[model samples]
Structures are given as structure tokens and as C-alpha cells.
Target: MVVSLKESDFFSKNRRALAKWISAVEDRLPEGLEFLQRHYHRVGHAFRIGITGPPGGGKSTLINALLRVFRARYPEETIAVVAVDPSSHLSGGALLGDRIRMDAIGLDEGIFMRSMASRGSLGGVSEATADICDLLDIYGFDRIFIETVGIGQLELDIISLAHTNLLVLSPECGDEIQAIKSGIVELVDIFVVNKADRQGAGRMVNDLEYMLGLRVYSGEDWRPAVVSCVATGGSGEGADGVFELVEKVESHRSWLQARGRWGRKNRRNLERKLRQNLFHYLQREFDFLQPLLEQKAEEVEKKRLSFSEALEILLEEFSRQFSSSLKKRKGG
Candidate 1:
């Protein structure tokens, strides 16, 4: 059975309550939607940061180091992490291996971590990721980190939810640099070259810089910064370059706020969510058209009707049935 919590109980800062709410939201429970509708005003406060990269880029270790640094830097601030892991083909469940590496930082009282299964979402983020982030934001977390499942060059969905997006790469990313130059370069605000202690790290940095030079940027545009980090070893051992990386991230954040683009980005992201919700709602409302669609498809296949004519017929039937349904609901 799903558990439900009162708004007051949720606001009282109970972590277990918060965790239960996350589960409800992920499951799309009615109470979860109700809570979101009630307290949506509490959102838009947390700074959501997205981190993505190819597999074996040391992203988990980097995040572990980041949590330590962030905790020390902002002692009073609460932090939340939503790590999206790839789902199993057989069970559709995630191993959530990232949490193991993050255990040290997870022990901090001010920090909260949740692992989510991508569940066949090719974009590297789960469908509920944005909503989960909003929940964490409403919970009054000062900062939220969304780590995507290992992704390729074109899986750039993180941009919609992230105020600042970091694409983590490593010293062995020479080929990766070439592969993602066309797509990822344009969207990323920061290119984090993790495992900077490895050989060819300097070359990778230079390569990224040279690639940046290839793009034409005006004085006002935010050019993506490439920072190298040796984010190997234990939780906090190789945090040497992370300080600079954090500084660069902060600079980008400041740039966004100074130029008045911060709010605009959030608005755009909200618009995207609205559109997605509308699409889902329409799909549910028009689900009764499935039989007609199948019949029309059969007609087309049998050459009894042209494709365009069949589609027109379906649309007309859809309009008529939709009107009838609305009238019946309205007691007409």
C-alpha cells in the first residue's frame, strides 16, 4: 500500500516523509500530484545542476568529491542528489551502482540521495527526474544535482532541467571529443574533464579549447568552460582540481543571473513540461480512437481508401465523438 502524508508533515522536514513522497510521485499516485499542485510555489528556489557523460568517466567519484566540497563550503545549506541509473533489460530495475561510491557523502545529515532507474528512457534521464527534482526543490534544498545515466553525444535532455549542465569527460576522450563536437558542444555550459591525473589529460583540455575557438561567440554569450579534475581515489582524496571546477560552475551561474537568462531558462523548462503534460492528457482523452485508427489502417492496407482519405475520416470521427463525449459529460 502507498503511504500518504499531510502537507504539514511534509513541511516539517521529515526525511522519511520526503522519501515516501518521492516514491508516490515516481509511481504517479494521485496524492503525489495533489501535493505538487498544492506546494508548487515552493519550487524555483533550488539551483539544479545536471551532470552527464559517457561510462567510466569517473562521474560518480567526481560527484562524491563535489558533495564533500559543497558541504564544507555551504555548511548550513541542504543538498539533494538524484542519480539516474540504467535499468535492467529483464527486470527493468536499476542496480544504482553510483550510490555505493557516494556512500561517504550520503552519510551527511544535510545531504540526501536518491537513485532512479532510467527504465528504457533513451535520453539518459528518467521521465520522473524533473518532477523528483522539483520535489527536492520544494523540500527547500539549496542545491540539487541530477546525474544522468551514462549517455552518448546526442542525449542532451538534461539541458531542459538543469540551470547549469556539466558534461564530464576523461583523458581518454579524444574520440569522444570528435563524436560530440557537433551536438554536446553547443548545449553544455561546462565541460568537466575528470581523471586529469591520467596521461593525455592536457591534450584533451587543449582539444576542447581549440574546439571552442571553432565556434563563433559574441561578447554576451556564455562560452562553455572546460575544467580538468583528478576526481579518482577515495571520496575526497583527489579533490585538487574540483575547486577550480566549482569556481567555474559558479561563474557560469553568475553569468546566467546577471544577464537575466536564469528566469528565462526556468520558464522555458516549465513550458516544456506543460507541453509534455498536455500531450499525455490528450493521449488519454483520445484513447478511444484506437479501434477507429486500426480500422482505418486496415482500409489503407486493403486499398479500400487512400491514406489521406482514411486519416481525414479518422479526424472527422474523432471530432464528432469528442463533441458527443463532452456533451454527455456536461449533461447536454
Candidate 2:
């Protein structure tokens, strides 16, 4: 018997249950799929911020620090963090230990953290991360933080999902000309030069400022700010102050524009997932017809069956199956 999400007496309203519901959606669970179409709008209220930088740039430390800062400020609200680490090619599982490093925060009642394996997805961690965020939103988390796996060009993927994108770099990243570029430098809403105590950091900041000065921005929103800091020692006393500046600039109009972009991206992502799932379902439906595709040289190989004819036969086969199932249900 096929599982049905809506018809069954299930407690999908619970937080953990909702999370499980999202996992079901990830696998294209027919039972849980109906709820998503009707309730998706109700599940999106949190302010999403994406954190991304090159590996070894202290991204985890920065995220840890932000959690502390945000938690202290909002005593009544819960925060949800989604950390993504790419799967190891050899093992096909993630070696993600953001959970290990973030143990202290998870102990709190107000924080919920999850780690996702990239699963070879280049754009989003899983094709389901966005949907997973929607699940968390329905559970009542107000601030959503997504930390991207610091793989090459993957930073772009993370920023696209967030309202405010912070590009974390170091003072030594670029030489005199700031040669070593951050992956998503152009899209940065805030540029952080972490580990400022090191040499050449000062020059790095200057080079970034030089580049920013040449940029043209006619929008009322201020140009992206570059802040320098040491994530380890609480360096750059002013570094913590930059976040408020980011918030002030992100008005509803700005947010709507960002969501419009996200909406288009979501459409593309959904289409891709639908096509993949459709192909999988089709393969199972046509298992008995596999021999037709693998027909041997002597008999049907010489017949040279046209592609159009094969499609026609497959359509008829599925139509028959569907019609038969409907008739059987009606008879009962």
C-alpha cells in the first residue's frame, strides 16, 4: 500500500515531525508531497543570512561567534543553523564536523542546528536544503543561518539563498593589489578581513577600499562595508558592530528584490528535481519493457524501430496501467 501524508492521522505539526516531513519530501514521498503545495507560504518568515568563505578562513569560528551574539540579543527567539559540508568523493558521505565544533551552542534550548552533506550538488547543499529551511520556518525559528561548504565557486550558491551575504576573507588574502580574491567578492554585502593581527592585513584592507571607491551605486542602500577582525581573539572591536549596519540597510523593499531572485532560482531548482523524479518513476514503470530498448541485432535490430514509435508504445503502456488502476479502485 502507498503511504498517504494527508489521509493518514499523522502529527506533522510537531517540530521533529516537520523535520521528518521535509526528509520525506526530499525523497519525493507521495504521502507528504500534497502538504507542501498548500502550506509552503506559511513556512517562510525567518530572516535568512548565508555565511561563506574559502576553507581555513575561520568561517566556523565566525559562525560560532555570530550565534553567541544573536542568541544574547534575542532571549525569547530560537535560531536555526544549517551547516553544509560536501560529500567525500571516495566515501559518498560527508565528513562534516561543524556539529562537533558547535557543541556548546546546541546544548541551549533556543538553538537548533543541523548538518547536511552536499551530496555532489553544486548549487545547493542538497536539492532539499531550501525545502528543509521551509520546514524549520514552520517550526517557528526566526533567524536562519546557512553556512556553505567552502568548495570552489560554491559560495555563490549559498549567497543566493540568503538575504544578506557576508564574504569573509583575511588581510593577507590579497597582496599589494589584494591578489588573492574572495570567491564571492562582487556580491558581498559585508566584507570581513579576519585575522587582522597578521602582517599585510592593513594593506589588504586598503586595496579592497580602493576597489570599492571605484564602484558605482545609485541605490539609497549604502555600499557594502569592509570590516577587519580576528575571529579567534575577538579582535577588531568594531567588527561586531557591522551586523547592525547590515540590518538597517535591508528594508522590505530590498528584501522583496532579493526574494524575487530567490523565487526564480527556486523555480529552476524545482523543475530540475521534478524532471529527475519523473525519470526515476518512469524507469520503474517501464521495467518490463527494458528488453525492447536492448533488442538484439538479428531480429528487431534490422527492424530499426523509430524513437517516435518507441515513445508511442511506452505512452500506451502507461495509459493502460493508469486506466486499469482507476477501474479497479472504482469497482471496490
Candidate 3:
């Protein structure tokens, strides 16, 4: 029988149990996941907001600021932040900084901070981010904030998982022209100019204005707004909506189809987690794949096999292992 945790159990009496439960949930363990699903109904009422941008865009600082506002405005509300970032190359498999960046709100008893390392999973996201959001939502968090890695084009995946996609940009980001890039412009809901006290803040705002003008002329009804923030100050930073520069979320026909993609998207996301599980079964975490990849490299070096042939073997092994994993799950 499943052990039922009561409210008293959550209040210091069973603190360690709660911690382990949360850890298990973040890791996406199958056994621990059941507790979440069974109790999800208790946690199913929260708004999920997604914040993403390029590296050093001040997303962490901005999120920290947002949490302060939320706490003051809605004093009774509970908030949770899930930071999805790659493992620091030097640190092996841990976030570059979660406690440091989130120092603004981490100490708050009302705010809960959780960092999920990408651990080499690609697509610029944490595999469990959305699921964790859902779990936090059901767990009674009033607001759930998801912070994505700001690297390359892959980070945009946060759009499918969040109700609001706040695309944060640093005032000094490489070039102003990047604002008009099709892929970046389309997915961003709110354009936040973080580190606004910096020199390029005005120029960055002007460049964005020019870009938005071109977009306004288009038949698109949804107009993305640009907001300035000084995230380091922890004031109006990441406060993209503070200056009336907020994207009015209207129900768009196209966007509905776009937003509706979540259902299908979640399915694919679950499949990815499943694949991670299958790989873990085959290799016991990181051992199998890297060694196999290394062997493939050696084979290629000696002309023993082509890269395609090596890839085929890997795929075949994955398929075989995946089928076996499914059977184990069935038997379990």
C-alpha cells in the first residue's frame, strides 16, 4: 500500500521525507513519480510562467525580482522556481549557479527553489521541467516560474511549456539586428531588456522598437512588447510588464493552434524522458553511451566501420533495449 502523507507530515515532522520526495520528483523516478500523480490533485492550481533568453541575459536575476513582487502582491501565495540549465562543464553534472543567482528570494520561506541540471540532455532544456511545473502546480504553488538555459536556438523549447514566454535580452548582447531574427522574434512573448542601466540600453530599445514597427505593419494581431529591467538591482528588472510594455495575451486563432501544441508536445516530452530511462537501463546512467561512442570513434579511425554503420548499431541497441525496458515495465 502507498504511504499517505498528511499535512502534519509535511510540517517539519517529516521534513526529510518531503525533501526526498521532491528530489525524486525532480529526477523523474518512476516509483517516486506515482506519489506525485496520486497527490497531483492537491497541487493542481498554479500559473506557470516561462522565462528564457541567451546566456547572461539576466533571466535568473529577473526571476528573482518577479518572485519578490509576487510575494508582496499576493502575500498568501506560494511560489516555486525550476531552473533548467546545463551542468557546469567543470562541475561534472550540476548547475553553474542556482543558489547564487537566486539569492534574492532563496532565503524566503514562501519561495522554493529547485535546480535541475540538463546533464547533457539537449534541446536546451531540462527533461523534467514541464512535468515538474505540473507537479508544482498540483502541489499548490500559486506561481511556477521556469527558467531555461539561454544558449543557441534550442532554448526556445520553453515556449511550449509556459503560459507566458518572457524572452530576456541583455542590453549589451552581441548585435541589435538579432532582434529581427525570425526564430527569436516569433516565439518571444515579452521582450525584456535586462541590465538597462548599461550604456546600450537606449540603443537596444530603439532597435527593438524599429523591429516591432515592421512587425506591427504585418497582419499579426499579437504585438510583442519591450520592457527594460535592471535585474542586478533586483528592482524593476525582469519586470517587463511594469512599464505598460506588456503583451496583452489575447486568444489568437493561430496561437490557439500554436498553444494547443502542448498536448502533442507533452507526449513527445514524455517519450524523451522514457528514452532517458531506457538508456539508463542499458548503461546504468552515463557509462554505456560514452564508451560506445568512444569505440565508434576508434572503429572509424581504423576504417573498421563508417560513422553511419556505428550510428546504426547504436540505434539498434537502443531499440532493443527500449523494447526490453517496456517489457520490464509491463511485468513490474
The TM-score leader among the candidates is 1
Residue-wise C-alpha lDDT for candidate 2, range 1-332, written one tens digit per residue: 44334322233334465555655766657545666666667754676777777666677777776776667666787888888888778865557755677643867878877777777776646656766676677667888888888753435466445666776666545532344354345566776676778887788778778888877766644477777766665413454433443343254326446547446544554565566546646666667656644553223446666666666766786778756756885894
Report lDDT (CA) for all predictions.
0.84, 0.64, 0.66
State the lDDT of candidate 3 residue by residue for 154-218, as single tens digits: 26557656655677787667464464476678666677788888888889888887887776434
Which parts of model 1 are misplaced by more than 4 Å?
A: 2-4, 89-91, 181-183, 233-238, 280-298, 317-332
What TM value does model 1 have? 0.88
Candidate 1 per-residue C-alpha lDDT over 1-332 given as tens digits, one digit per residue, 9 for 90 to 100: 64667777778999999989998888788889888888899899999899998887878888888888888888999999999888988876677754876764656899998988888776877777888999999999999999988865535568778999999988776688878856668789999889888899999999999999899999989998999888754435456688888888789889989999899989988887777666656676689999989998999999999999998998898789878878996899
With a 3 Å backbone cut-off (N, CA, C), the pairs that clash in candidate 2 are 5-31, 174-178, 174-179
For each candidate, what TM-score against the reference? Answer: 0.88, 0.66, 0.69
Q: Which ten residues in a row have the lowest lDDT in candidate 2?
A: 3-12
Candidate 3: residue 54 lDDT (0-100)? 75
Candidate 1 vs 3: which has more lDDT = 1
Off by over 4 Å in 2: 1-15, 152-154, 175-186, 234-332
| TM-score-better candidate, 2 vs 3 | 3
